[model samples]
Target: MYRVMRLIRRFEERSIELVHSGHIVGGIHPYIGQEAIAAGVCAALRDDDIITSTHRGHGHVLAKGADPIRMLAELTGRSTGLNGGRGGSMHAADFGKGIYGANGIVGAGGAIATGAAWARRNDGSDVVTVSFFGDGAVNQGVLLETFNLAALWRLPVLFVCENNGYATTLTVAQAVAGSITARAEAFGIPSVSVDGTDARAVYAAAQAAAARGRAGMGPSFIECTAYRFDAHHTWEHKARVRYRSDDEVAAGRSRDPLDVLGLADEVRDRVDAEIEALLAEAVAFALDSPAPDPAGALDHLYATGLRTRDGNGLLDSAVR
Candidate 1:
């Protein structure tokens, strides 16, 4: 678990550098301070289980066993990307590994995951699914609706909310009325709130939830209270949003998740060094990867090997 947390930390740091260097266009929502939640929840899932993620989701994808090189390629929009360069940073997906997708829409993954779990159960598979979302998603109607369905059908889905204090510029207090857990409770879904900064606590909570879901118990929800130590988006470097005070930022940085892992200084240093090396290799692979050709943009839009008409309105007989 410690190693996985370290991997996510280094991956985010390297990804931030890539964004600044213009290697990753459209920028990214850095998961710098929220590594613990991804690491912990993924640790509790079986390899065959599924997960859906949000815009701030690179950490979740990485923690779920996505290859770093391919993830970096995806962010760089290379042909070797997880989505074949079609879905960049906010839309990477590795269905082979049970990662449904990293959705750009906030809170939409919950319903998608619920449906996936329901389908799997109907197919006689006991694979559970997890949906990772931000605090802002708590207000989304689809998420609430999915909660009701999951509870009613007793679907094997886990909802993990990474409550990082603010949703873009909006604070949780301003955006969310009433409590997050209470919403889950309304549907009779057992929910728990834990410190998002503590990786172990999240792992324990997720483990228990996964156990219950696998045992045919209904869905579960976890509200992980955490703080983002960086800007909400890389564009903040130019936009300069002043929603948070300097003191608050300083205080949040004080509780670094890496430091809280409780490993000895020597062990932590070794782990950091190893992760740095791995990130360097990942970046090199991403840089050397080929970009997808524009002519083949719709290659994987369909799974049946069928091709759609080109946007230029050229019929099969027009060229001949």
Candidate 2:
């Protein structure tokens, strides 16, 4: 668990560097402090169990077994990306790994996960699905509707809320009117809150919830109270967002998740070396790879490989 958290932290830091250096075109939402939540939740899931991610989702994708090289390539808009460089940061996906995709919508993934789990259930399989979202999603009507449907139909969906206290610059206290757990309880779904800084605690809670789902006990909700060690997005590094005070950030950083591991110096050194080597290779691959061609931009726009016509009812220039 600690290793996974460490990997996510290092990966997020490197991504931020790429964003600053113009290597990665658009800025990213760094999942620095919330690594424990993703690491823990994914640790308790099966390879076949599906999960949907949020905009700040690199950690979740990595924990779910995405190749670092391909993921990095995707962020850099390389043709060798997992989504052929189309999905980029907020939408990278690996369906082969049971990842639906990291959506940019606040609560859209919850609906997608619920639907996916329902489809799997209809097919006579005990496949479980997890929906990961931030605190901002609690107020989303679609998410609440998903919660209702999930409970009503005994769907195998686990809703994991990474409540890092803020929805962008809006604090949870400022936005959420009622208790986060109570929202799930109102839908007749069992819910709990766990320490978002402890990977083991989150894993145990998620494991129990997944067991209930597999046993046909319907959906479950877990609210992870974590803190974002960095800005909400890499762009904030240059912006003047004063939502959080320096002291508050210091307090949050004090509770380092790596402290839980207490790994020996030699062991830590070895892990660091391995991660550095792997990231170095991934960076090289992303830099060497070419961007997707504009002519093929609309190649796979539709599921049936259908082509669209221009205003003249002829094939688009790209397709032509």
Candidate 3:
């Protein structure tokens, strides 16, 4: 858990540097402060357990065992990237690792996770699916609708909401009307809220929820209340958005999830050195990788064995 959280923290920090250095285009939604939520929850999952992530999802992807080298390459638009340079930061995915994708749309992953759980159940597989969303997603009709279906059918889906108290600058107090957990309770789904900074607490809650799902009990909801230590999006750094006060950010930074696991000084130093060396190699690999060719721009856009039509209605050999 400590290693994962530290890796995420350093990775995001390095990504921010890359953004400033012009290597990573379009910037990233840095997952700096919310490391423990991803690390702890993923710690409870099996290698076969599926997870759907949000736009701010680098932590979740890394926690689920994605290669940092390929992920950084993807962020830099290199062909060697996880998605062959197509998905970029917000859409990188490795299905073999059970990461469906990091969705750009808010609340979209809920349905995807539910569908995955339902399919796995039908396959006679005991695998569970976890949907990681934010506080902003609770009111999304799609998520609520998924909650209804998941609860109604007793799907093995765990809804993990990373409630960082804001929906892209809108405070939860301003946006949420009532209790965040109550929203899930309304659909008769069991729910719990945990300290997002405490890795142990998150792991315990996630383990219980995953166990319940595996036992064919039904869906569960976990709301992790953490804080966004950096800008919601890297663009905020240049735009200088001032929705959050400096003092509030400072106070929030005090309870950093990365520090919750108190490892020995020697152990911390060794891990830091190891991660630094790994990130150095990852950055070199990303920079050395070539960009995708324009001629094959349409590749991977359609399903395999599917054909396309040209203007005259004949099969498009170019795509074929």
Candidate 4:
């Protein structure tokens, strides 16, 4: 878990460099401080267990066993990307690993997770699904509705909220009304709140939730009170947006999740070297990959394999 958190931190740092170099076109939501949350929750899940991610999702993707090289390629819009480069940073998906998708819309993953878990249950599979969202999602109607449906059907969905005290620039105190966990409890789903910076705490909580889900219990919720050490997005650095005080930021940074594990010098050094080499290769692979051709742009617009037609009732391929 410590190694995973460190990898996510370094990955986000490298991703920022790529954004500035124009290799990755768009600015990304840096998952710096929230690395422990993804690392911890995923540690309790099986390889086949499904998960849905939010816009700040690079950590989630990497934690769920995605190849960093291919993920970086996707962010760079390469044809060999995880989603053929169409999904990019906000929508990367890998069905084979049960990663439903990383959604750009706030609170959208909850419904997707519910549907996936219920579908798997009907198919006679005991596969569990996790929906990761931020505190901002507590107010979304769709998420609340998902909680209800998940509880009613006893769907094996785990709701993990990374409450980093802010929704973009707005603090959680300013955005959320009542208790975040209370919203899920209203749906009769068991919920717990834990310190997000402590990866082991989150792992223990998620393990209990997974056990309950596997035993035919309904959905569970975990509210992790964490802090975002960097800007909400890479663009914020350029925008120079400042909402929290320096003292508050310092207090939040006091408990560094990467340092919390207290790994020995030898093990930590080994992990650091391994991650550095891996990321170096990932960067090279993404930069060397070519962009997809525009001629077949609409090729995968349909999942049913139906091709779109051009003018005169002919296929677009005719022009190519």
Candidate 5:
């Protein structure tokens, strides 16, 4: 778990550097402080279990076993990316690894996870689906409706909410009326809140919730309370958003998730060296890869390989 968290931290840090150097375009939402939640939750999940991620999702994808090289390539818009450079940072996906995709929508992944759980149940499979979202998603009607449906159908779904105390710029205290767990309990789904910085605590909660799903109990909810150590997005680094005070951010950083690892100094140094080597290779691979060709832009747009029709009702002769 600690190793996974460390990898996620370094990956995000390198991604930020790439953004600054223009190797990775359009910026990214750094997952520096929220490593423990993704590491712990994914550590508890089976290899076959499914997960749906949010816009701030690089950590989740890495924890769920994505190749860092391909992921970085995707972020850099290289043709060798996980999604052939089409999905980019926000939509990086590996279906064979049970990761559906990192959605750009705020709370839409909940519905997708619920539907996946329902389908898996009908197939007589014990597979569970996890939906990872932020605090902002709790207020979305689609997410609430998904909660209702998951509970009503007793679907094997675990709704993991990474509440970093803000919905973009709006603080959770300022925006969320009542508690986050109460919202899930309103729908009769068992819910719990855990210290998001403590990977062990998050792991315990996730294990219990996953067990409930596997035992055919129903959907469960876990609200992970952590702090975002960096900007909501890389753009904010340049925009210089002033929502958080320096002291508050300091307090948050003091409870660093990496501190919980407690590894020996020698072990830590060895692990750090290994991670640096791996990241160096990943960066090289991403930079060396070619960009996607514009002519093949619509290649994987549809599964059926259907081509668009021309204005005169004839099939377009382009190389679809």
Candidate 6:
């Protein structure tokens, strides 16, 4: 678990550098301080189980065993991306590894995961599904509807909410009207709140939730209270948003997740060295990969392989 968090931490740091260097276009929702939630929740899930993620989801994907090289490529919009360069950062996915996708919509992944859980239950597969969302997502109607359905149908879905104190520039207290746990309780779904900064606490809570789900106890919700040590998006570097105070940012940074895991100094040093080596290879792989051709832009638009005529009524030239 310590190693997992360490990897995610380094990955986020490197990704931020890529964003600034123009390697990753369209910027990214940095998950710099919320690595523990993903690492802990994924550690509790089986390899065959499924998970849906949110905009700040690179950490979740990496934690769920996604190849860092492919993830970085996806962020870079290279053909080597998980979606073949179509989905990019907010939509990277590998269904073969049970990662549905990192949805751009605030609360959309809840329903998707619920549907997957329902299908898996009907198929008689014990594979459970997990959904990771931000605190702001609790107010979304889709998530509330999903909670009701998952509870009513007794689906094995675990909803993990990373309540990192802010939703973009809005604070949780300012945006959320009712208690998060109350929302789940309204639909008869069991729920709990845990320390989002502590990886062990999250891991234990998620483990119990997954256990109950597999035992046919229906879905569970966990609200993790955490704080982001970095800006919400790379654009902040240019726009200079002042929603958070300098003191607040300093305090948040002090509670580093990597330090909370209590990894031995020797272990930490070794992990850092290994991750540096891994990232060097990932960067090379992403840069050397060929970009997708314009003519094949819609290659995977549909599962049936049906092609639509271009708006100009002519085949678009292939990308050189």
CA RMSD for every model?
Answer: 2.1, 2.1, 1.9, 2.3, 2.1, 3.1
Q: What tens digits encode model 2's per-residue C-alpha lDDT throughout 259-295?
A: 7557788888888888888888988999999999987
Candidate 1, residues 163-277, lDDT tens digits: the string is 9999899999898889989989999999999988889999999999999998999799999988998888899977887999999999998887877879998988888898889
Candidate 4's residue-wise lDDT over 1-320, tens digit each? 98889889999999999998888887899998888899999999999999999999999998988888899899999998898789999999998888999999999999999999998999998888999999999999999999999999999999999999999888888888889999999999999999999999999999999888988997999999999999898898888988988999999999998887788989999999999999999899988888999877878877865667874667768344
Note the Cα lDDT for every prediction shown: 0.90, 0.92, 0.94, 0.91, 0.94, 0.90
Which runs of model 1 end up more than 4 angstroms from their true locations? 310-312, 315-320
Q: Where does candidate 5 stray beyond 4 Å?
A: 309-320
Query: Per-residue lDDT tens digits of candidate 6, residues 74-160?
Result: 888898988877878899898988999999999999999999999999999888899999999999999999998999999999999
TM-score of each: 0.96, 0.96, 0.96, 0.96, 0.96, 0.96
Colliding residue pairs in candidate 4: none
Ranking by lDDT: 3, 5, 2, 4, 1, 6
Q: Provide the clash count, candidate 4.
A: 0
Q: Which pairs clash (backbone N, Cα, C closer than 3 Å) in model 3?
A: none
- Using alpha carbons, what is the TM-score of model 1? 0.96
User: Across residues 1-320, which tens digit of lDDT does each residue of candidate 5 receive?
Assistant: 87888899999999999999999899998888999999999999999999999999999999999999999999999999999999888999999999999999999999999999999999999999999999999999999999999999999999999999888899999989999999999999999999999999999999999999999999999999999999999999899989999999999999999887577888877888899999999999999999999777657656767557555767677733
Give residue 203's lDDT in candidate 3 (0 to 100): 98
Local distance difference test, candidate 1: 0.90
**C-alpha lDDT of residue 151 in model 2:** 94
Predicted candidate 3 versus true structure: per-residue lDDT over 90-206, tens digit per residue: 998999999999999999999999999999999999999999999999989999999999999999999999999899999999999999999999999999999999999999999
Name the better of 2 and 6 by lDDT. Answer: 2
* Runs in model 3 lying further than 4 Å from the true structure: 305-320
